[model samples]
Target: MSMAQWVETYGQGTVLAAGGVLIGLSFGFWAQRSRFCLRAAVIEFWHRRFGEKLSVWLLAFASAVIGVQLMVLMGWLDTGSARQISAKGSISGALIGGMLFGVGMVMTRGCASRLLVLSANGNLRALLSGLIFAVTAQAALGGALSPLRTHISSWWTVEGGAPRDLLAIAGVDHWAGLAMGGLWLAAALFFALRSPQRSVWMWLGGMGTGLSVAAAWGFSQWVAAESFDPVQIQGLTFSGPSAEWLMRVMHWPAPPIGFDFGLMPGVFVGSLIGALVGRDWKLEGFSDGYSMRRYIGGAILMGFGSMLAGGCAVGAGVTGGAIFALTAWLSLVGMWVGAGLTDRWLDGGAADKPTSLPAEGFKRP
Candidate 1:
C-alpha cells in the first residue's frame, strides 16, 4: 500500500513516531560509528590535510538527495516538503543565519547534531554549547532580536519561486533529479573507496547519516498530516525547536508536538544509549574556564544565527538542500563563509593553522 494510505489506515501518530525512532536510531548508529561532523569537516579542510571528514559530509548530502528523491518517486514524501522549496525568497535570512551558524560551529567546535552526539559522549563542553545554543536560538526566534531577523528577511526574494531542485533546474523529471543526485552520490563513494584513509564502515556511516535526515523529513510530513496542519511540515533541526521550547512560556496555545520535537529528544536519548552501549559514556566538562567562556559565546551566536536562518545545519543544510531551496543554498554559502572567517580568526588570521586538537580520548580517523 502507498505511504499515505498506510498512514491513513494505521495511524498518523504511530507512523510519525515510528519514523522518528528510525531517524533517531539511524543517527545514533551513524554518529557513533563515523563521527560525522560539519565543524570537524570544515576545520580539517582548512587546517589539516585530511579530507575524510569533509568527504563524509558530501556522502551524506548525496545519500540524502537519493533517499528523498526515491521517497518522492514512491509517493511517500512530496519533494516540495523541503524548506528550500517553501522559503525560496528568504535569501537574506538564509545567508545571514547560515554564516552566523558556521561561525558558531567553529567557535563551539561542532555543529548542532555533532554537539548532541558529543554531549552523549560525556563532553561537558558540548553540553554547554547545546545549552547556549538553545538559549540564544530562543532569543533570536522570539526574543529581542526577532525584529531584526524579520526586517532583513523582508528585503529579499527569489524569482520563479524556489529554484527548481537539481533536476527541475536542469529541466528534467524527478527520475532525472534522482539520476543526477545518484551520480553525485556515486562520485562521493568512489572518492571514499579510493581513499586509503577511508573505511568501508565510515562510508556506510556517512550514507546512513544522510538517510537519517531524509527519514526525519518523511516522518515530519507524516506528523504534520496527522495533526491536520499540512503547512507546517519540517524535518530534523536543532535551532528552531530549541528556541520554541525555550519560548514556550510566551507562545501560549502551545504548538502541537511534531516530528522535530519528537526526533530531537529521541536523538539525544538514542545517542546517550548508544554511548553507553559502546562504553563511551562519561561525565565530562570544559577544558578550562576560558574554554567554557568560548563555548557559551559560540552557542549563543549559533542560537541567534539558527533562529534567523530558520534552522540549524541539519535543518537548513541537509533538509533544505535536499529540496533545492534557493535560500537554503544561500544559507550553505553563508555557513561556509562564516566558518571560514571564524576558522581564520581562531587560527590567528591564518586559516591554515589547526586551532585545536580532537579531545583527549577521541581517536582521530
Candidate 2:
C-alpha cells in the first residue's frame, strides 16, 4: 500500500505524530552534534573560525531544497498547497521582524533551536529563555502584540494573485521550483564542500537534518491531503510550534494539540538523548541578575519578531527559504544585517561579562 494509504489505515494522528517524533529526534541529534545556529552561521560566514558551521547550514539547506523538490516532482507534495505558497508574506514584517529576531538571538547567545538543545543539556538559562520565548511569541501571535504586527504588515503586505515564490519574483518559473531548487542545491553544496575543514559526521549531521526537513514536509503534506481529520501542511519551525506545544502541555487539551505538539517536546527529548550519547550534558544557569534580565529581554524580542516575520530562523530562513520563498530570503538578509549590528553593539558595551552558556554556537566566531 502507498504511504498515504498506510497513514489512512493507521490513523492520521498516529502516523503524523510518529513521523513528527522521528524527524524531531533526528533533527535534535544533528543540531546538537554540529552545534548548528543560523545567527552563528551568518556571523561565521563573515568572521571565519566556525566557517564549518555555516557550511553545515548550507549543506542542510541544499540537501533539503533538492529533497523537497524531488518530492514535489514525484507528487508527494503539491508545492502550491503548502501554507506559504500563495501568501504574500509582508515585506515590512520580514525586514523588521527578522532584524529583531537577529538581535534577540545574539543577545541571548542562541536561536530557538539552539536554546532548545541547550535546555535539554540542563541549561536552566535556556529553559527559561525557551519559556519566555514561547509566551512572548504566543502574545504576538494572538495576544497583545498581534494588532501591531497585523497593522504594520497589512500596510506593507504584498497583494495576492502574484507568483508565490522568489523564483517567480526573480523571473524564473514558480512552478519550476524543483529545477530552481537544483540550482540552489548546487550552489550551496559548491560553497560548503569548498571549505577546507571537512568532517564526516558533520556532513552526515547536516545531510541528515536536511533530510529530516524534507521528510517532514512530504509527510505533513501527505497526511494533510490524505487524512480524514484536519491537518496543517508544515515543516520544521521553532517559535510558533514551541508556543503551541507549551500551551497543550500546560493546558492539557483545552486547545487540542496539533502537528507541532508532537514536534516540540520530541526535539527536546531527542536532544537530550544526543547530549547523553556525546556526554555533553551539563548543569548551567544564569551568572547573575544582569544575565537573567538579558535573557528575558532577548526572548521577548525573538517571540515578537518571529511572529511578525512569519517564522523564526529555522522556519523562515531554512524551511521557508528551502522552497525559495521571497519572504524567507528577505528575512535571512535582515537577519544577517541585524546579527552583525548586534555583535557590534554588544562588543562595545560588555566585553567582560561572565559566560553562562557555550556561546560558540551563537557568538561571533
Candidate 3:
C-alpha cells in the first residue's frame, strides 16, 4: 500500500514513528559497525593522524550533504519549512553551546548519539552518561536551566528565513551545494584509500549512516505532504527526543507518538543487534570516582549545550550542516575547535588514549 494509504489507515503518528524506526535502525547499525564518532574524528584530525576514524566521519558527512542536495534538486525533498531554516537562531548560543558540547564529548568520550549507541552495547558508563544527558537536556528544554539557555540564546539572535539559510547568504544555489559535497566526498575517498584499515564496512557503514539522515529528511517531507494534519519535517536529533522520552517515562499521559517515539528504541535495538553479531557486547563501568565525575560533568554540559545550540553534534553538525543552516555551520565549527583545544589541554593531544569503555567493534589505530 502507498504511504498515503498507510497514513489514512493507521495514522500519521504511527507512520512517522515507523519511518523513524527504519531510519534510526539503519543509522544505529552503521554507526556501530563503523565506530562513527565526531569526537574520534576531531581527535584524529587534531593529532595530525588522518586515519580510519576521520575518514569514516568525512564519508558520512559528505554522503549526507550529497544525498540531501540531490534530493532537493530532484524535487523529492523540500527543506524550506524545516525548523533549522525557518526558526530564529542564535549566534552566541551556537558558539558557546557548541564549544561546551565539544568539551563535554571529550570528557565523556562520546557525543549524545554515540552515548546511546554505546549504552546499547552494554557499556554501563555510557548508559549512565546517556541518562544524565537526557535529564540535563530535559532541564534545559523546560526545567530550571531553560531560563539560562534562553538568556544566552537571546544574546545574539538572527532572523529566521533567508538570514538563517547559509546557501542564500553565499549567493549559491543547490548545485553549488552539491558540488561542495562532491569535493568533500573526494577528500573522504582519498583519506579512506590511504588508511591501511579500510574495509567494506568502512565504506558501506559510512555511506549508510549518511543515507539514513537523507532518508529521514525525505520520509518526513513525504509524510508532511500526505498527511492532513500538520507534521514536523525533521531528521534524527537526540536532544528534543531525549527530553521527550524522559518526560514520557516520568509522567502519566504519554506524549504524541511521532518520529521520536520510535527513533530512540530503534537505535538502541539496532546497536544491540550489531553488537551481538560482532561479539562486541561486554559489560563495562566506570573505573574510578574521578572518571565518574568527569562523565557526569560532560553529560551535563552536553545536555545544556545541545539545547542552547538548538541541536547536538549529529543534529546541528551533520543534519543541519547538510541543509546549509548558518547557525549549524557555526556550531559545527565551534565543535571542531572546542574539541581540538580540549583534547590538547586535557589529553595532551593524545587521540589514542584509552577510554573507560573503548569502542569495542571498531578500534582506533
Best by lDDT: 3
lDDT of 2 at 311: 90
Model 3 alpha-carbon miss at residue 325, Å:
0.5
Q: Which ten residues in a row have the lowest lDDT in candidate 3?
A: 355-364
Write down the TM-score for model 3.
0.97
TM-score of 2: 0.89
TM-score of each: 0.86, 0.89, 0.97
The predictions' CA RMSDs to the true structure, in order, are 3.4, 3.0, 1.4
Over the stretch 1-365, how does candidate 1's per-residue lDDT look in tens digits? 76677567766655665666668777866766676777766665666444567678878888887888788888888766555574445667778889989998887878888888878778888877887788777766767778887888778756434263545666767787678678877777765766567876578878988888887777676556655435456667777766656555567887665455456667777777767766888887766777777778888888888877767787888777776666666787788889977877764533343234443233554
Judging by TM-score, tell me the better candidate of 2 and 3.
3
* Candidate 1: worst-modelled 10 consecutive residues by lDDT: 353-362
Q: How do the candidates rank by TM-score, highest first?
A: 3, 2, 1
Model 2 steric clash pairs: none
| Model 2, residue 265: C-alpha shift (Å) | 1.7
Of the pair 1 and 2, which is ahead by lDDT? 2
Which candidate comes out best when scored by TM-score? 3
For each candidate, what is the lDDT? 0.72, 0.77, 0.90
Distance from true location, Cα of 363 in model 2, Å: 10
